[model samples]
Target chain A: MPSPLRDLREQIIRAASVAGEGHIASAFSILDILWVLYHGILRHDPGNPSDPARDRFVLSKGHASLGIYGILAQRGFFPMDELKTFASSSGRLGGHPDSRKVPGVEASTGSLGHGMPMAAGMALGLKIRESASRVVCIVGDGECNEGAVWEAALLAAHHKLGNFTCVVDFNHSGDRALMLGDLAGKFRSFGWEVTEIDGHDHAQIEAVLKPHGGDVPRAVIANTIKGRGCTDMENNPAWHHKAPKADELEAVLAQLT
Target chain B: MRRQFVTTMERQLDEDPRTVILLGDIGVFAFRNAFKKHPKRIINIGILEQATVSVAAGLAKEGFIPLFHSIAPFVVERAFEQIKVDFGYQALGGHFVTVGGSYDYAALGCSHHCPGDVGLMQAVPGMQIIVPGHPAEFDALMTQTFASGKPAYHRLSERSNREARCVTFGKAEVVQSGGGPVIVTVGPFLDRVIEAAGGSDATILYYTTLAPFDAETLRQHAGDGRILCVEPFYEGTLAASITSALRGKRIALSSMGVPRKFLTDYGHASYHDAACGLMATDIRARLDELSHV
Candidate 1:
């Protein structure tokens, strides 16, 4: 049997192929983090997705929605068969996740830099209510170009939201050259507890994601390759939004297996 | 009006534990007491308009009634996408409190002027747009909006009318009884429209809310079809709604508002109003011509 990560990758590829289009590479980069959180770290019940006590996960890098959809379906938030109908008008899912349409989607986010502030607000609300629930947000390295991200960062730190955690997918696959120097230092300056990890290393991902009750927020810079599983597509910018053809898909599936 | 806003917010904070006020570092002094009384609830999220709105959406999702406040330009225009996706797309319930309507801070230049906020917000589906006419109206609308448990935008202005009526959402208040062309006043422009009428038999209808426009009420009042709409924002912001409301009727309509042209001259808001023919005199002149036609 394949590892959980391999199985998720296979599901992601099958969905992308069926949809005929998706941000497969972008989804692949964040797969391990999503896997670890959904499988181990997040305090959630698949039977009760809207439980008040459950931890919240926001996919701030929403273009890579396939990654989230796979995890949600795999974790039993919905049926796995629904993945085949992704990006179809008949299907509930769209190119970007819509919270109203999809089960377990906390917020509708396709436009970059929106999810961080939302997660911060959720964390603040949870803190106000004195609930043990935590909020985990995943944003793309490319998506940090937005000014709102920093605004939320400042707010989270200023408010001392220890219940909030942000994970940046440092895949270096933005349309432009990745010029963000010392990402960890920048987060530290904003007063976040910054940590660096090998994104695909399940152990490292889990270690950083473990919730620590502290005054400052946490930021985990997960160093990853864009098309993580398949070597030919790894760190390849061209694969950002392009779906693989049948032959390529078969090869990718074989490699994952 | 600012005082009334603070008072009502304090009451809300005391009454409703779910009420939270998020500001973009704009109303630090104006809302001091409310902030002091409820430090955690009345949050000054620095100068981040985008985060301010997105955070409100999050708060709304968590069953908190958040009132995100800022200047009209920054609150309505800057974080518009978040307003659309985070609030409207998620169907989250919250209130967006915006001051500096149109050219309230005209001397401060274009950045402060927000004549396009109403029109921009109208583009977002399911947003209730309210432009209160006075302190009394502001007090009532703010209370109702919070209690309504829905997404709303309360566009406040520095200007106020002498006459105060019981204001409600999606309903027009008939300020004066008359028999000639119907003059529809929105926001604080009710005072000017009353002045423009100037003893004319023209009926006056004032509105605090622009969305869910009381078209049936408009039709009942403006049966003659001669209507002049005086709004505080961009010209004809309410035209489409009015036209839709009074459709199938032979209506002779003329709209008076801030022109679409960018005003380079920096002066009082009244100066811009005068330049754009939004004041009472210009409104009277337009009404006279509409009467002739």
Candidate 2:
């Protein structure tokens, strides 16, 4: 495992430990994609987070907030010290991301199936204004159960919002309830240009994050494990919402790399 | 009123560059000329009401004023969560102009009926509810609120009052004031309320905006603490605001509007009005009873 990626996982674990509550496995599932997005893909300035020409990214699956918080902090959107205040009443970082309180957060989202449609709307608005700004929305594979997700898919396709991109974190977390079979085919049938990739690969993620220059929107289905690096947490439903207790913290940290 | 809405919105599209209209596969022909002139601004965005609202919120976030047009039930009831979360929670400003509220689509049965829109919207914090009684009033309210930077619901109806009263955003207009039970009418129910209180010395207050309820106006003219509220939508919709406005005073409040139940029978709006006891004669009887009390 790469040292930087392992370090990020450690940061996520420590933050969750301090908060004593978080969707740790869920955060682990999308950490690489978020890291790649903030590092290379999204054209956002940490200092000027509300730049008119900056690209917009909406975390439709906002329960994995620890992942984005770590990335944003690493990118200097806020100080790294704020991570300790996660889920505390005194902190701006809640279990879900709030755009108003956080500098780089574009949309406030916690309830599933909201961010994609909002991203489609932002993409449509940018297209109308003839601006170069783009919008990227990430949704959990489990979140696809919502009717609003498909509604947004249809809308983005119908409007031919070329500036929009939807990334699905296919961690198979939702398989226990309902299986989303053939996601790429479903997106293609909905008129989106579909691409499937290993979500943990930084190079693979970076390649598909650029403009495709098409009339229709793009969908990247990112295949990922629920907890990628940690042995005890990987694809473990028990770890889905659990933070490490003080006694178990050392053992979990040892498994990160 | 829908015609006036089209003309008024057409003029707005021409005058304001930031104005945008998103239709839910309804009122496309009415906006044909405006679409030709500003095709990018005027869009029939299909029948997906939930997506339309989120899309409007997105546009609002980008500094563009977006108006979503559709039937009341589809716009307000079906896409309510989107309006609540996307617009209200996000603090984004947009406009929702809906038709066929109450029993306006009475012939279409329960599937198309939405009497709980105002009640539903009132639950959302910072939501502005506007029920226009006349075409001119619709035009007036739409002009003032389209760019006000708040989520405003402009509910239009097929019915209209005989004359246009002086309309304000949050303030109520006093149509007739006398030393009698205060009769407050909302939107197009003004004329019927007036007829119900004819030959009596009753105070009539007309309300267009229901969210920032004109409690001050009601408090000023709530004579003898006897108040009768006649609304075109659900009954007792204004009960909380009325009671809250005059909390300390002893008051007898009676409400007459659409009953909170499904009207299974298929008929026009007038027939439904009669079924709900909203006709002038019915209201007059209620007014008389209130006066005697």
Give the per-residue lDDT of model 1 (tens digit) for A51-101: 999999999999999999999999998898899898998998788998888
Residue-level lDDT tens digits of model 2 in A1-257: 56887888898899999889999899889998998888878899999999998999999999999888988999999998899899998999999999889888888888798888988988999999999989999999999998889999999998899999999999998998999999999999999999999999999999999877778999999999999889899999999899999899999999986
| lDDT for each residue of candidate 1 in B1-293, tens digit (9 for 90 to 100) | 77777778889999999999987788789888887688889887878899889988888888899998889999888999999889877878899888898899899898888999999989888888898888888888878778676689998888888867799877898888677899888978888888889978889898898886888779888858999999898889889998998889989888888899777889898888888878788999998998887
Model 2 misplaced stretches (Cα beyond 4 Å): none
Fraction of native contacts, model 2: 0.72
TM-score of predicted chain A against the true chain A, for each candidate: 0.96, 0.98
Q: How accurate is candidate 2 locally (lDDT)?
A: 0.91
For all candidates in order, the CA lDDT equals 0.88, 0.91
Docking class of 2: high
Fnat, model by model in order, equals 0.89, 0.72
User: Residue A57 in candidate 2 has what lDDT?
Assistant: 92
DockQ of 2: 0.80
